[model samples]
Target chain A: MANKHYAMVIDLNTCVGCNACMAACAMENQTPVWKNSWRTYVHDLEIDPGTDHQVRRRFFPRLCNHCDNPPCMSVCPTGATHKLDNGIVLVDDELCMGCRACSMACPYDARFDVSYNDVEQGKEFYGELHHRTRPGVDKCSFCAHRVMKGLKPACVETCVGSARLFGDLNDPDDKVAKLVKTGVAKPLMAHLGTRPNVYYISEIERAR
Target chain B: MEGMFYSTQNVWTWWIAIYLFLGGLGAAAVVVSCLTNMYIKTHKELVLWGNISAFVMLSVGSLFLFVHLLDHLAVIHVLNPFGLLTKPDAWIMWGTQFIVWMMVFSMIYTLPYMLETPFWRDMPLVGTILGWFGWLGKLSLSFHKVVGWLAIINGVGTVLYTGLLLQSFPAVALWHNPGVPLLFIISAFSTAMAFLLLVLHLAIKREEDHDIKVLYERTDVILISIELLIIFVFFHFTTYGLESARHTADILWNDMGWIVGFIGFGLIVPFLIEFRGVTKGWNSATPVVLAAILVLCGGYLLRHYFMYAGSYERPYPAINSIHSQSNYNLLIE
Candidate 1:
């Protein structure tokens, strides 16, 4: 709990939008494709038209913010959605009642309903086995399975452009910490005060 | 519309709307019943009817909500009473605790009267139990008086909790407003009155009092007017509050459910009908019943539209460039 805030930083400058990270995340997490399990996906954004009349589509990767004060966790009736001491918010599938309260509470639209059929179909379609047998809320886990084992998240490890970086933000020696200290990275929707752990190193005013 | 479902976009649907409506109605009914029983001691039969109807309504509403849970098998997780003390922030947890206590207290409050009924008097086991506790009847009556206040408090909590449950969803702009609970409680109280009026008119015609009926009609009219005002404030606040809130307001403004169903039919028409009781007089049970029916229908529509009008803010719209510059300019910064 002391100085152990794990975070992810995405450098939009270097991101090529190849989607290798998205595929890697899906495979590693055994997420379903039917419902568009966009735990990590590259979004194409069209910049506002300038005075010179030019429109450029920028590649923006999106996922759960893993907030310090997650609304989803606060609204959960059964304590099914919780945030770990290491700063990773996760869902307890067995405890979840599938009330969809967390889904509505998430400002990031990060949570998705995991039906029994969805999980079963996911196993067949992706040919990936999952340890979670029950239906509940599903979302990005920040690769907690691997992170706890000292391995980088599949998305961070497989990024072709080296855009994604995972490290302890509380550690000053960490590159993500330096980047954040230098104001090269910032969390999304800061105005809403969720205090997201996922930061994007971009200077775009619109994203702010 | 057939293709439409509540879970389609992760937005709530009909089940939740109906649940909110029923929950509020049931809670308000209980509170009203308890209040009547506490103050109007002479109408024992009427109070008894109210208590029975309130219990039935609350239980049925709770069951419907439970049935609507997605992971129905895991409902025990919510039912575990320990979570009430543990999960203080969870409004749903608070709601569950309130509901359970309300039911328990309501039953205890009604027990003495229930046993006094002819059916229970004839049963040998019930008679024997009554005989055994006959000496303690005075103590039970005092306990009932104290428990009646507790039930009323819980009843209000149950009604308000339903609104707070929805309002706790910070992501949904329409539901996140402070006015939601106010609107819901007002509608709940009005609907409760309508229900009482209907039952008194149809079921207890002999013992029905004219002054109480007139008071309820007047109170209902005022409630409807306040409801309309709060709804307007809700829309106005959201329309100007945030972009996300504006989106929900836009939905409510355009949708027929809000315009025709909730506003025109639910509030205005009913307000006009109930207004007649104040300006003129009710004169007959027909107008009172008709007005009551309209209010009830309107109350349901209010909740249904409230839920349907809720829409999430578009999540993290991808911004490609900013500051009147291209991505190349961003790199320099």
Candidate 2:
């Protein structure tokens, strides 16, 4: 009833496995400098067990699934974590009890602990005296803050190929909706029932 | 290998191990104080309910964590939970706070009831307020969620959070398997049972009627049976998956599964001792001691595995190795 469903369409056909999307996400969100992946590429299969995995690997970058029934949301003791009407789960960093329950509840390892920069730490101070902190969990928000400002996500705009599409699936007339109407997309880790917003359109299975 | 793919219980294992041990300790402390309340029980022969419970709960719970944490703190760089989120042990910040609060509160609550007498009627009131706050500590048990929705958030949150910690981890494939949370819920029930037995033993001036004692012990028996089953199934999954799955757990244990600890002196042995006490009807100080020891040890073992197996793990090889294995390229190439 709350216009909460979100949809993402990723065209595997055009994706050249470039990591522009991940970089864009990191920079746009001002993610912690030392944090690993804010978003990542998952694959339909594990890499072929070989020494040349990176070169042969078909990139399946992934972000949060924004499930309709997030286990993390239900288990929040302080109500610090919640799913928005748009189906994304966001944490109130200010209110978080600093408990790791939601991080634990996430089936996809979607929650990560990162100490957000107190102020926008410019690139000059990229790596420096790091401090241990009572960390909170972070995940992709579909770049919601940017979307409301009437701009495409940095990742979507920077894509060399128009491979990533973000829009309201609820608007049947929207482009993402049209693509979803025809594109056979799959959510990574669908078996876990997180129902991620990012979807992949693939036609063939490659070597693992 | 054992808990691979799943993540919730990895955290839950830690929460349960810590909380379960702490929870037992809290209950045990109450029992010990109850025994000390000589004013309430006039007929020593009537039956010692409260004091017995307190000692059992305290001794057993303390036994479980005391030795293990001594070992862990010696090596870990534990950061205070109040700090920002940069620390690896940040998740533990809230958990440790909860454990500390609960232990203190349990002591406070037990003291008033254990020492309740005509001379000091108001002493229990001080404990009551603290008890309320301590109960509030239960909400903090989940650590990830903040304190928002309502006053009751922490207690209910602890239950679910504790459940997830054990079942959510990745390498504890079996612990995070389908039945672990169910087991933890049962563990809470068992902890409650252990708590009650300590109550029975600590009766001060009067002895509990034989019938009420029977009820509590029977409940413990049934719950233990259910708990043992849960543990059995959990082990079944871990051992089987460990044998077949990928990852370090396949080796019977990696450095991380040290949560299992040294063979005879390890956590499982403590559990076995309790199990033996349960079967032999060693319900007095012995069962309480055994249960407290085992459950607490079990809880620590749970956390130890998660720390050892998942999260804050060493980085992937500096060189990307995803494609070298046949498993990587087809998925990637």
lDDT of each candidate versus the true structure? 0.76, 0.48
Could you tell me every candidate's TM-score relative to the true structure? 0.87, 0.60
Write one digit per residue (lDDT tens) for candidate 2, span A63-130.
66677766666555445567778766777654554345566555555555543342234243444443
Pairs in steric clash, model 1: none
TM-score (second chain) of model 2: 0.45
* TM-score of the A chain in model 1: 0.92
Instruction: Please provide the root mean square deviation of candidate 2 (C-alpha atoms, Å).
Output: 10.5
CAPRI verdict (incorrect, acceptable, medium, high) for model 1: acceptable
lDDT of 2 by residue, B148-260 (tens): 12212222333333455545443234435657556555555455545555445553212444444445455555655676666556445655544322242433344434534
Model 2, C-alpha of B293: deviation from truth (Å)? 3.8
Which one is best on DockQ? Answer: 1
- Which digits, one per residue and each the tens of the lDDT, describe model 1 over residues A52-149? 88986667888888999898888898998888999999988888888878777776667666777876887687664556578777788999989999
